[model samples]
Target: MFLAVGLGNPGTRFERTRHNAGFRVVDILAERLGVPWKSEDRFSWARGVVGDKTLYLLKPLTFMNLSGEGLLAFFAHHGCAFEELIVIHDELDFPPGVVRIKIGGGVAGHRGLQSIVEALGREDFVRVRVGIGKPERRELVVDHVLGVPEKEESIILEAAEKRAAEAVLCIVEWGVQRAMNVFNAREENGQKEAC
Candidate 1:
């Protein structure tokens, strides 16, 4: 069994914010798989199959800072190891519309990831980072992440979410290595020549 976690704060108020990119990607994946979400243990989740592997899509309701609590509960209940988890979250380093998959790294100031690392006491889980870009001014970082994007920016983020969802499916259907090869090297032009 594989656990795919999308990190974001709960509540309708944060629905379309840049920080909720992970939530959007998981929603897309659930829609594509025709799975319905159910509330359980402080999180919303849907279960489905990709190829022959069982997939669990999770969205923690503990907000960004306490995300690890929800993840820990799910892991304990499902007996899932850190290696069997794939966490999706927004990234400020890459430009908007850029998506990358990696395994085991520092949180880079993402509270959601930091919480997860704290809860799990490990950094071996896979990460599917959906870039939302950084703010122009350092002081605007908080507002930028929590702010809704403009129409054009929204389009870019939407595309990134879709691609990120695909990358998650690829991980389950193929494997992490192949998914990284196909997705991490992708360019804005949709070219996969090289990174």
Candidate 2:
């Protein structure tokens, strides 16, 4: 069994925000798999099969900062290990429209990731990172992530979200190394090159 967790604040207010990139990717995956989400107390989830693996998609309703709560509950219920986990989230370091795969890394001060690490007592799970870039000023970081993107950036991010969803499928169908080799490539001038 594999659990793919998407971190975000729940509600219409955050639906189109940069911080909800993870949610967007998971939604895309759910649609492609033709699975319907069933709401629980701590989170919403859908189940489907990819290859021979049982895939579970989860979106924490505990919001971004407390995302771990929902994940912990799911883990306890499913008795899943950290190795069977994949987290899809927005990346402030990379440019918009970029999607990358990472394994066992620091949280980079992302509250949602930090919460997961705290709950799980590990940081070795796979991650599908959707780039959202960052604000010019450090002080505006919160507002920037919580706010909706501009028209052009929104289009780019939508593409990135779709790519992130593909990355998740690749990881499940193949392996982390293979998915990284494919999705981690950088795009330059409309062409893709190794990163």
TM-scores vs. true structure, each candidate: 0.94, 0.94
Looking at candidate 1, what is the lDDT of residue 157? 94
Number of clashes found in candidate 1: 0
Q: lDDT tens string, model 2, 66-168?
A: 9999898776776775347899999999899888898989999899999999998999999998889988999999998998999999999999898888889
lDDT, residue 3, model 2: 85
User: What overall lDDT, based on C-alpha atoms, would model 1 receive against the true structure?
Assistant: 0.90
Q: Write the per-residue lDDT of candidate 1 for residues 131-160, one digit (tens) a residue.
A: 999988989999999999999999999998
In model 2, which runs have C-alpha deviations exceeding 4 angstroms?
Answer: 81-83, 186-195
Candidate 2: the clashing residue pairs are none
